[model samples]
Target: MNRFLRTLCVLVMLAVVAPALAATDVEAVKQRVAKVDVLRGEFTQEKQVAGFKNPLRSQGRFVLAQDHGVIWTTLKPFPSEVVVTRDRILSRQSDGSSRVELDGRQQPAMRSVNAIMFALMSGDAQALSAQFTVKVEVLPGNGWKMQLTPRSAMLGKVFAQLTLSGDRYVREVQINEANQDVTRIQFAGMSDTPTTLSTDEGRRFE
Candidate 1:
């Protein structure tokens, strides 16, 4: 083929391939996040109130199971653990006391947390779409970023947005919520499959 013709053909091919590749990457990101079952990691949480003079900082370990729930345990700057399940929230303090908040039966904020947990566990894009305008962007070096903005007024008041970033190995979930609260969690060491929490652990939040 002529040089010009060959170059033209290559360009046409790239034009078609590029968009398909981009769409595939977007789907891959969704799939990658959906497949995560159990996630255990260390995290740094920073909270800024609307009128606070300083941001509160804490270090913690996070445990999440797709079926059972999420346990956020803060070990530094005050020890506490928040266990979340389908039914309720169990918050335990370093003093060995616990408070339980019922699921849909509780306050608005608790219900919101339950909704978030359900969405995370189900990986239901439709459910999430109702509350968040989500976009997935693949970054260089095989990394990805999923950004979510609140679609509802209530969600907006509670959670401003969330930006999650991670690579091919395991996904890192970073949550940026209302009032400048940020949770940066990286999942480095993971099991081959998602694990299920015991009945007791799952009911700890009840």
Candidate 2:
């Protein structure tokens, strides 16, 4: 796999698993997520690998539509876009050339990745529990924190743990990999109102 896809796969996997949580708390988290139909935000991402002295940094904007899926556009450190839907994953370069594309029907893993990402973004805790052990904690103020550990040995070998913190929507994601690599992503300027998609953004999904 390419660097981008590999990184994305790991990140998406992180979104799907959690430790263990009380039934009520889990339900609460789900309710909070259910209120959001569309999510738009900007993100800063830092990635640290064993041999690098400095972490790689990237800035991006993302839109997650409940019906259309996700459109992630990275504008800094080189331009690229990744569109992930229930049936396909498409990657494009700054020049608008295709980098990679995967059909879920042809690839089971792709299908699972899509499902997991939707569940995570939507805060469908019950769906996540089917795949991972989940633990939830109330934060100091208004938010909640969640930790996810993979159930499959194969997945465990890829990620040590994934921690997510947020109130009504996901605010931060921290990923610890078994290979000693780490990634942290912080999100800001989020909104869910005006749930409709623009014409250009809608085209990406098709």
The per-prediction CA RMSD against the true structure, in angstroms, equals: 15.4, 3.5
Of the candidates shown, which would achieve the greatest TM-score relative to the real structure?
A: 2
TM-score of each: 0.70, 0.83
- Candidate lDDT values, in order: 0.53, 0.69
* Ten contiguous residues with the weakest lDDT in model 2: 15-24
Model 1, range 32-106, lDDT digits (tens) per residue? 433555656565555554467786677766666656666767788988766666665556684657554444464
Backbone clashes, each candidate: 0, 9
User: Which pairs clash in the backbone of model 1?
Assistant: none
In angstroms, the error of model 1 at 160 is 1.6
- TM-score of model 1 (CA atoms): 0.70
